[model samples]
Target: MHLLAHRGYHAKLPENTLTAFASAVEVGFEGIETDVRVSADNEPVLFHDRVAPNGVAVAALTRKQLSEVCGYTVPTLTEALDALPGIWWNIEIKTPAAASLALPILSDYDSSHRLLVTSFRHDVVLAAAEMLASDCGLLNAHRPAALSTLLHAALPHPNLRTLVWDCEIVDPDILRQANALGFRNAVYGAKTLYEHQLMQELGVHTLITDYPQYVGLLPG
Candidate 1:
């Protein structure tokens, strides 16, 4: 199983900032997940919230203007790929526009071995798959449901290899069902050592957590 830094280890620095991403690399995390949104000028930027820290909506500012006002510049998809070379990325498209913007950039980057495009929105996932085709893997974030329902929903997508479930949805049965479906399922919000052990025992491929270090990825 792998330990993935959530929003670039936000507990240690500002979430989705380049600084935070760099810190995750420094700590030797193999993968990092971050949210992407398009600015008013149509440049893709790494930011989770529609509203900025100052209560200004991100859509209200151009990418360049957003950088001047927000202290951190809005980074393009290209910029992020350049900044974090040689690391696997889980880039979540936050909206349809972002999905559209990301597909081309991802293709241009064309590092299918190093990037997985994911989205909570089903439409975004479909669009990304259509655009990216076989170049990148698609990860689906789904709420926990009955084993039968999960099996039904997942059976059609042969290319879908990763699933992220809410922390509340994790149970032995669910984990078993996901494993049966050939998915590398992960539970979010793992706050304790016991939870980490439970996930590891269940064969979860990754743990999305604020404290990646506490999950005991590094040798004692």
Candidate 2:
């Protein structure tokens, strides 16, 4: 299974920052997952929360102000990708407006670098699939009632080849169905050794985890 450092191995370092991303690389992770939100200046920056610690919306602050508010430098999406060009990125767009801003930046990126642009917003995923050369994935926490129908609907988009599901809802049958429908299954929220073993047994394509050090030690 491919292991992606969720929020860039932030067990010690602050998450969604350049330092964390570099640390993820230092530990030999080729993939990193991070969230994207647009600042008030319309710049796509790497940040996870809807609101800052100072009780302000992320969209209400400029990138520089966000860094000050958060007490650490908040790297713009471009800054993060430019600094770490080799690693595969799982860019989770946090809002539809963020998608509008981030897509243009992502379009200018080197196409040779692998990217799996995903979002809980299906609309954003569809929009990204149409515009980007990179692979786009639909992220879902809860299982949809018509799983096959959801797969069939997404299969038409050539770039939409993966489904990022919450590990709580993933099982062998889920993987089998996703595989049968031409979807590679990626799961997040797995935090234990048993869960890691279960993902390997399920034949998951990717495992987004918080503890890469431990997960990486598991036999591939």
Candidate 3:
């Protein structure tokens, strides 16, 4: 089982900021989950939302211009790789086009040994699996009803390694079913220490949490 810092232990710093990521590593988290969106220049930047600070959509601004307006520059996918060492990355491709922008970066890192590409967009995940081929592990994010659809779409690909389930959608039966399918299951937003521990006991192999320290795996 693994404890992942959601948005890099967001309670300790701004979500998705370098400071937050570093704090997660310093606190002994093995994996960090972050989101990726493409800038106008088609550069893969680490940001979850499509809208920028000044009310402009990210699609409308060049990567350079976006950084200038947002104050904190968006870190490229490569920059994240350079910033965090030894820790595994749960990089979520937020849009269909992001697969193209992120696939090359994943290849350049070529250390698929340490990367897991995930996406809520099944098409994007499938495209990335095809693009990266056997070079990386792919994870699909799904709700209960959509799980079967995701499985049918991704099972033929050997690179699709895991399934991340929404916390509210998870049940004991589903956990067993996912395990039978040979996919590891993960839960997100275990808000407290007890909740986190209980989820681990419930056979959740990975947890994405805001309070990493509360999980008792990191220094509070």
- Estimate the TM-score of every prediction: 0.86, 0.96, 0.87
lDDT of 1 by residue, 60-174 (tens): 7788888887776667777778888778788888888888788788877654437767777756765666665432233435554565654454355555556776666567776
How do all the candidates rank in terms of TM-score, highest first?
2, 3, 1
Q: List the residue pairs that clash in candidate 2.
A: none
For residue 110, model 2's alpha carbon misses the true position, in angstroms, by 5.0
Can you tell me which runs of candidate 2 are displaced by over 4 Å? Answer: none
In model 2, what is the error at residue 63, expressed in angstroms? 1.3
* Candidate lDDT (C-alpha), each: 0.72, 0.88, 0.75
Count of clashes in candidate 3: 0
Task: Name every residue pair that clashes in candidate 3.
Answer: none
Candidate 1 local distance difference test against the native: 0.72
Give the TM-score comparing model 1 with the true structure, all chains together. Answer: 0.86
Higher-scoring candidate on lDDT, 1 or 3:
3
Give the per-residue lDDT digits (tens) of candidate 3, residues 24-140. Answer: 887878878998888888888888788988999887788898879867767888888888857888888888777778877787765443777787776777777777643223443
Best of the candidates, TM-score: 2
